[model samples]
Target: MTKRRIFMAGAMSGLLLPSIHAQTGTNTRIRNLRVLCGFPPGGATDAVSRRVSDKLQGSYADVSLVDNRPGAAGRIAIDELKRSKPDGSTMLLTPAAVITLFPHIYEGINYKTDDFTPTSTACQVQFGFGVGPGVPSSVTDINSYLRWAKANSGAASYGSPATGSLPHILGVLLANQSRVALNHIPYKGSAPGMSDLLGGQVPAFSGLLGDWLPHIKTGKARLLATSGKERSALTPNVPTFAELGFKDLVMSEWYGFFLPKGATKETANAAADAIAKAVRQKDVIDAFAQLGLEASASTPTELGIRMKEEFRLWETTVQKLGIKIEI
Candidate 1:
């Protein structure tokens, strides 16, 4: 064959090889999606991840599994995701605390918000402050609670899920704003923290609404105020911090999905579309509602923007509070 013909044939072969291989099923089917959650099973993060995964499974027949890699305040799973292939098959489902707050609070975190491609924000969950029944204050709102707490002269202590978790930060912020001196206590997990609160071991605890809802209903603990901009639908009578004149006290934990960094924009968009479809399902919404979590999804761009805003807010708060740790 002529030299030009030989070169042209080789170029055509190069183009057709991949197509032939793909058609032969040598390419992995875009099924068997794996989702990573950085919390143990039965935790709020785990519950939300599973709910989203089930919805995704229903919408996309390919999704087959959801994996939990809970450790180091989500850093372990996040690091694993960073080292994963930049393919669409592996997804990380986690709360905003890991991405936006961990890097600022912990000294040795290896993954940052930029390390992953955001797919979609699945939901925003509100937090509530619950005081053990032992506290003398029968206050129902933040203002009254703060006033009573101040009168107690730092005797009131609050428990948080972990040392540098979102609830810890919220407790610190609440003390700073309300001029209430509170001794901060940290627990290994929300379950333990809620246990102490229910048993009247701690005067108060601040964490996810889901963790505190049962205790609230059982009259073991009283809901002081929600940390969101508005009252939660599950607890409409509970006033928000903003309504009580603490506008800056807003805090809501949120979860989002991410693919490894450098994934193609097409792949990211496809994942986001899939999650959005999943979020719209009635069963998914109802399931999350049962956990006191609002079911919603945002575009990848919106997730990015929200992450940036949250990072800035947490950075400032951490610096202001002088919270430094080596987790």
Candidate 2:
């Protein structure tokens, strides 16, 4: 009848269960967790979501799923996340731009930065400016490329994942700063833009580095520069925009996790712990590297700070660029 004996009896039976999830320090169990993704399957965003979902399967929920609702340039998934409950059962994994940059560019987005709770970031990827056979082989670096673009104004164009994406913004910055007349060709996704780049339909492409890796290895594409403070590890041979005297163009996109706005701090911390653990694993890091992404984690507070900082930065940049989406 002693307390220790009674506790031992409960532990021997199933009465003292659910404490097993205490390894994450939170006792909440999400029976059917759905990680909403705005991109389709087989894309970078979906891959990140699935990788984190794998690690969260047993620890955070009995089953973890990635719900792909790709449409309206990743707005569909965000809409779904807005409608989801705050019980920690629904989570969203998306690029930081969708939350930070979209609001400034899109005319009628229903969600705002405050609509979701920042949980943690899964990975970050740098954008690359590359050219395929469309450009003259002599155009090797950014300076030469600018010269060529300036001379061949008719053929001077760059394709990005979308009109309002970070890559698009970077392209616009490059064109304006360099005083060139480069046109923007926005594709629905990186794949199609990459396809056009490889086909010589587009002389230049600005997108995630992963989209250019395959062609780069095959000698079909050449990376002129990347959008990062330092050179990207994947393409160290290529200089960064900052190195090329584009100090204002240093940027990278991070994919972050989120919950409904009303989720409590406990739930947010639990999800962040699981995501941080998931992204730090050796396999996850290697996988992200193959995808041209750097696997890293951040606290809820850190993620929130990053979101606010990037949101304000984008607001100013977008307004300055005067770029807006019709739909």
Candidate 3:
């Protein structure tokens, strides 16, 4: 049979026949495909995981599932992934920080960057600093808040998702650039930290732009500044740290897909192709936008390059900041 006939047969049956071994023509049927997520069911990570799983299920002929294994800020789920066989049956959909930053911060983590293969980035979201009533009504933007922090005791305090997380790093950078003494309060996650920020328990909150955008719209919180090269599309009125002169402060969090390190080239390529196709769909893009996420995709090789670059960048940043976590 011609190769075209084989390809057509595989497509019709929802199977990838001999994708990695065209010469041998060993047909591989993908089954019980699991997309593992490290966070709880309702949070951002789980949400993104389920979305991708839904899209892939529609595209693939096999059953796809999103399995949440929440514990230790994704370490448990990652450990589960590390133990799984690298046969393209299991994949992880998680935040880039989990792969890029966690190793440097946690002293006793179970996984390393070498344990997985990069597929594609699913979406990107910006970071921001939010303010609540503890900050005086006169304070509007980052510069004014900096000035106010210098005089007020609790005004300069800020909360982040966790120690050594990107938001924590942002606060550290802000202190260094503005030469202000800002207290860094680390929370288990952004939800509770944002809660304090909105309840006046904390004056400032540092986390994703999505976490605070809703409250900002309702007049319940103030987005002092965003952490991106440019203002977020959803909050154009707010200035970015870079535009305000701290160009180094620009950053974004990403959700990305990864397979086990030993997965075959054909497996990785097919996975990347599926995700690239899914994210480009108008409905998927619009859904991501509504969540304040920017939909994006990259080839497996491009994702690998990004992973290596980000691993280097974050490694240096963590070292320079002397950031570490007890657990």
Q: How accurate is candidate 1 locally (lDDT)?
A: 0.78
lDDT of 3 by residue, 1-327 (tens): 111111111111123232222222534446556788877777778888878888887454266777777766577677767876677667889898888888887777667678888888999999989689888889998988898999885557999987777888889999988889999998878889988888889899898888886898899898989987888888999999987778788788889999887887777877888888888989888878777788889988988888878989988988987877756
Clashing pairs in 1: none
lDDT ranking of the models: 2, 3, 1
Candidates by TM-score, descending order: 2, 3, 1
Candidate lDDT values, in order: 0.78, 0.85, 0.80
TM-score of 1: 0.88
lDDT winner among the candidates?
2
Candidate 1 lowest-lDDT run of ten: 2-11
Those runs of model 3 whose alpha carbons end farther than 4 Å from true positions after fitting are: 1-29
> Each model's TM-score?
0.88, 0.91, 0.89
Which lDDT tens digits does candidate 1 get at residues 1-327? 111111111111112111110112322335556678887788778887777787666444354366767667776677667877776767899989889998888877766678989989888899888688657656766777777778886567899988888888888998898878888998888889888887778888988888877777877788888988888998998888888888898999889999899977777777788888888889888878878889889988999999989888888878989997765
Quote model 2's TM-score.
0.91
Regions more than 4 Å wrong, model 2: 1-25
lDDT of 2 by residue, 173-275 (tens): 9988999988999887898999989899999999998887888889999999999888888888989998988888888999999998898999899889988
